[model samples]
Target chain A: MAIAEQLQEFCGERRRDLVRFANLQLRDEALAEDVVQETLLAALQGSDAFSGRASVKTWLYSILKHKIVDTLRSRRREVPLSGMSNADDEDEGFETLFDRRGFWATEHKPHRWADPEDSLEQQQFWQVFELCLDRLPARTARVFMMRELLGLETAEICQELAMAMTNCWVILHRARMGLRLCLEETWFTR
Target chain B: MMNCKEATQLMSQELDRPLTWRERLALRLHNLMCSGCHQYRQQMAFLRRALRSRSGGD
Candidate 1:
């Protein structure tokens, strides 16, 4: 098979993982789909020197990761993102996003009618969780979902997202910690 | 009343196992002292169970 054809097969096979990783990086599902499409196109064009240092999966992931960074940098966002740094602020950074001192306004207890198994036959849970997921910062939320929701191994996540294992652990730790804190502080306090 | 942090941590672990003797005792002692935390825990427990029953991950 031609290198481009082989690479196309590779990208097609791992499309789900690519989209998942891209979504984690970009936060917007639609935008992440775009990035994955762009990554595959770029990969096809550069197939001449495709090194075997990393698995094809990892190489594609690396490309997608850099693409997200490049996109963000082009937009000139001053705040550094989580996946960009192997060990920057870690999960501790998300805690600050919550308004701790302010009363958690829990007057209207909106129940999530989001049971995938219940709502749709074989429904994708992401569509449901994505509702609240949008509220979290892209990096912190992605780390949390990749670990807790998707059940991806921490080691794989560390390598894919370019996060340290400690940072990965800390990210999960803080995600659980921050979500509970924010929910209680914001929803119940009011 | 249990402080928000303690209850939140307790709830996270509770997803995997039923509260142990030590946890139950600690929680009991905590509830006697903190009404807000106690009520918070009760409500959270109900919410969690409702979610769990739907999740059926177990």
Candidate 2:
């Protein structure tokens, strides 16, 4: 099969997931669609770069990740930092998980999370995972996605987001804690 | 003694950068005595692994 035909077929099959992944990161449906469109067009033009070592889906996602990050960077430039800073303020909800003395609150103590590795194989588990990711505050989710999903270094993330290193760490911590709690409540315990 | 809050912060930081030896010692000591924080660290690690595998997989 020609690389173009292969890519067109692949895109037809995976476009929805690609768009969902972008929307999850961008939190904007129209913007997500635009980015995915850009990604597909890039993939078509650069089909030679599609080394067969990685699966087509993974290759597509790598392209989409860059487009998403580019969109985010340009969006950041347009918006005033002051307006976004308030949204990024540490959420007090995280503090509720810990007591005044800084111990885990009784109701929020971490559970053993029986056989978490096994859950990764389940389709339902991914649904719960996406829901948990969706529940995170927008900026928090973006920061977490940039670090964890896109595999950006903390230093790079700080520079890209125009945030202090310490602030980046705090946001990542909040994301991990929040996702942990959400998965426990929604999947592991259930 | 490092409390669970501080210990968990170090655990999360461990993912992003190398922890100082002192920070590592405090987290290790806290994890030794505190099962909750210990499990919290494990869950964080699990989250990272799961996410990486998911992205890298078809």
Candidate 3:
């Protein structure tokens, strides 16, 4: 098949996963779709630039990630961090799990979760996890994904979001706590 | 004496940054004595692994 035809088919097949990945990062369907489209376009147009150093999926995903970051930077002006209220800011719900001295409250101790390796292979587990992620406030979720999903450094994330380093860490800590509690309540609790 | 709350924060921070000697010692001493904090640390690691795999190690 011609390179153009092959690239077209490749992009066609990978579009959904690419868009879904973008949606996970950006949290906006329209923007996610737009970035995915741009990613596909860049991949196909620059197909000759493909060095074959990485798999097609990985290459496409790298492009998608760049596009997602670009979209995030552009949209940064519209969504200020202060305007993105944290869902957990109203209460120290997780703190109640520990006593005044910092020990786990008897009733609030964490239970051992099912084997993570097993759960990672289970589609239902990811569904529950995704739902929990979706429940986080927009800014928190974006910051979390930028660090965890994109593997961006703290300095990079702070620069991208125009947020302070301390503020970034606080958001990340809250995101982790929120995710932990959400998973415990929804998936781990029998 | 580190509590579960502080230990959890350290656990989460460990994923993103290097822990200071004081924070490490506190968490280590706390985890040594507390089964619940140990479990919390394990769960947090599990969460990071899950997210990394899903992101294709991006």
Q: Report iRMS values in order.
A: 9.8, 1.8, 1.8
lDDT of each: 0.54, 0.85, 0.80
Q: What's the lDDT for residue A17 in model 3?
A: 62
Model 3 misplaced regions, further than 4 Å: A1-14, A86-88
What does candidate 1's lDDT look like per residue over B1-58, in tens digits? 4444555456555543377988877877866765555554555454444333322123
Highest TM-score: which candidate?
2
Worst 10 residues of 1 chain A by lDDT: A108-117
Give the clashing pairs for model 3. A102-B3
What does fnat come to for each candidate?
Answer: 0.02, 0.82, 0.67
The runs of at least 3 residues in candidate 1 whose Cα sits more than 4 Å from the true structure, single-residue gaps closed, are: A1-3, A10-13, A76-173, A176-190, B1-58
Q: Among all windows of ten consecutive residues in candidate 3 chain A, which has the lowest summed lDDT?
A: A1-10
lDDT of 3 by residue, A1-190 (tens): 5557656765676567667778887877888888878877887779899887666666776777777777777777887766766664565476688788877889988778877778888889988999999888777898999998887898899987777887888889989888988998998884
Model 1, chain A: how large is the TM-score?
Answer: 0.45
Q: How is the predicted docking of candidate 3 categorized under the CAPRI scheme?
A: medium
CAPRI class assigned to model 2: medium
| Model 3 lDDT per residue over B1-49, tens place | 7667778888888887899999999899989988888888898889889
Per-model TM values vs. the true structure: 0.38, 0.89, 0.89
Estimate, for each residue in A1-190, the C-alpha lDDT of model 2 and write its tens digit.
6667767875786677778778878788999899989988998888887877877678878888888888888888897444654455756477888899999998888889889889989989988999999888777888899999888999999988778999999989988988988899889893
Question: What lDDT, from 0 to 1, does candidate 2 have?
Answer: 0.85
